[model samples]
Target: MNFQKNKDEVFQAVANATEEAHRPQNSVKIIAVTKYVDSSIAKDLLKTGIEHIGENRVDKFLEKYEALADLKLTWHLIGSLQRRKVKDIINYLDYFHALDSVKLAAEIQKRANKPIKCFLQVNVSKEESKHGFMVEDIHQAIETIKNYDKIELVGLMTMAPFGADADQLKDIFSKTHALQKELQQLGIANMPFTELSMGMSGDFKEAIANGSTFVRIGTAFFK
Candidate 1:
């Protein structure tokens, strides 16, 4: 695949969608989900001006982390993390997009050497197949994790059910956006809830229209 061309196309799409949505330019960060590609492709992506890279598994994340350790890139761990793996990969990540439980937060607090930027994953759709806090539990979850100094709750992350239509995707993203606003009003310290990491390759435009700040794209960038 032509990584540069794909990267340009994705950026163009993001720009057009942002303008169509009346959102500010450069508002959405495109996290190239590098889980499916090898480190060589990831290095090529960095050369194309893609600064943010996401990996969903700890083993693969570390593999690429070791291979491309010299490049200046913002690394994102965008999958459900097992507590046991926290100590191994905590320091390498710039953002963790799947913090859903108090136990995990406590583990991160115990293991991280510095404040880790985290996006609490909310299962906004209440889908049993997804891994996140249910919508109703988010407020309490936030309250419980407030004392964990090692974690900086940056925002909420979620995925719409696969095969969802545009309207369905919009509803999911809009609801998550509203939740982010609600959390921000609480004025929790270090909780600058400014991001909404919703959307994937299929529904990113709808996600952008509904106030997504980061969109994770894999197939679009690799194909």
Candidate 2:
């Protein structure tokens, strides 16, 4: 596969979408979801100017972390993190995109040797298969976790249901963006709430239109 060509195409698409949406080109951060590929491919992505990479599983995350330790890449843990596994991976993560519960937050607070940026995951689509706080409970969840000193609440993360149509995806992303704004107004200490991490390969254009600051892409880049 022509990785550089694919990377250029994705960047161009991101630029077009941002322009159409009237958002600044620099506003969106494209995170290469490296879960589907091994460290060898991930290293190639770094050489192609991809600075952010995400992995969902702890085992694979660690394996790649060791293999690619020489590189200066930002690591994102973008999966449902089990509390028991937090200790194994917390120190290595630069951004934790699946902080769904106060229980998990507490564990991270107790375990992390340094402050970790985190996105509170919200189940905006209310899909039974997703792991996150329900839309209605996000406010309470935020309030509960605000006291965690080691976790820096930087933004919110969510996933639109697989195969959802454009309108559905837009609606989900719109509501999540609204929630991010609402939380920003709360002025909670240590909670910047400046990011909305939504969108994937299939519907990132819709997400960019609705104010997604970070788009996690895997399939489009790997192919």
Candidate 3:
């Protein structure tokens, strides 16, 4: 699998989804997950018009960040974060995609120096292998998180069930979007949930069509 070929495929997927969605005002953002690869691949992706990449581990991210600090990049945390690592992530990361627990959220709120953006990871798929706050627990977690002045709840993020078709993916993405709306109606309007971080290299186009602003691309960028 050629990396460049895969990148082209992901780029096309994003563009096609954007055109199909017909939301002329909004463009989809693809955060390429550059996990464990090198900075050269990141630079290649940047050259191909990708400006953001997610890293699962802080240590690995730092290794790539050191070389990429000079380049314009947005680092997103797409991994389950431990309490001890919150301070370190707070020091570097601009956005975290997996704030799945309220306990962890509190720690992040305390450690966050600036107004850091966040995505509440919801277990829409309800899978044991995945890490996220169950759908039923999300509202209470969001309510608790709303009090933190340092963290801004941007939207909901979800990892769809494996082997899911396009239709299933759309439903999950739409569900995440609806969750955002429910939160807004509950007087959480000051910080509107504008993003639905769902989808990946596999079913991202469908997620986009139904409404997904941030797509965490992994295998597509890492081929």
Candidate 4:
């Protein structure tokens, strides 16, 4: 695969989308989701000037993190993290995008040596199979999270339903952006809630238009 070509194309697309949305330059950052690739390929992608790397599973994240230890890259755990396995990868993460529960936040607070930047995952689409806080429960979750000194709530994340059409994608992302704005208005010290992680490769354009700050793309780069 032409890694440089893919990287350039993705950046250009995101820039165009950002401009079309009338958002600030560089407001959106892409996470090169490397869950399906190994460290060698991830390292190759990094050479093309992509600094953000994401992995979905703990074991795979550890393997790549160790293999690419010599390199300087921002690591993002963009998948559901089990509480029991928190100690293994909590300290290594730069950003945890799947903070779906306060119990998991408590676990991170227990294990982390430094504060971890986390995105409160919300089930915007309310899909039964998806994992995240329901719309109404986030208030209580944040109240509980305020006590966790080691967790910094930086943003909110949500996954739109698979095969969703443009209107559906827009609706989901719009609601997520609205929720993020609402949380930001709270002025909570630990919860800045400034970022929104709302898109994948397929529907990222709509996400950008709706104010997504981070979009996770995996298959697009690998292809």
Order by TM-score, highest first = 4, 1, 2, 3
**Cα lDDT of model 4 by residue, 95-201, tens digit:** 99999988899999999999999999999889999999999999999999998889999989999999999999989999999999999999999899999998899
Model 2 TM-score?
0.97
| Residue-by-residue lDDT tens digits, candidate 1, 1-223 | 7989999999999999999999899999999998888999889987899889999999999999999988889999999899999999999999999998989999999999999999999998999888999988877887778988899999999999989987888788899999899888888888999899988999999999989999999999888
Off by over 4 Å in 3: 1-8
User: What is the lDDT of every predicted structure here?
Assistant: 0.92, 0.91, 0.80, 0.94
Give candidate 4's error at residue 48 in angstroms: 0.5
The best-first sequence of candidates by lDDT reads 4, 1, 2, 3
Candidate 3: worst 10 consecutive residues by lDDT? 183-192
Top lDDT hit:
4
C-alpha lDDT (0 to 100) for residue 161 of candidate 3: 91
* Position 153, candidate 3: lDDT: 81
Backbone clashes in model 2: 0
* Residue pairs clashing, model 3: none
For model 2, the stretches where C-alpha displacement exceeds 4 angstroms are: none
Each candidate's TM vs. the true structure? 0.98, 0.97, 0.90, 0.98
Error of 1 at 71 (Å): 1.3
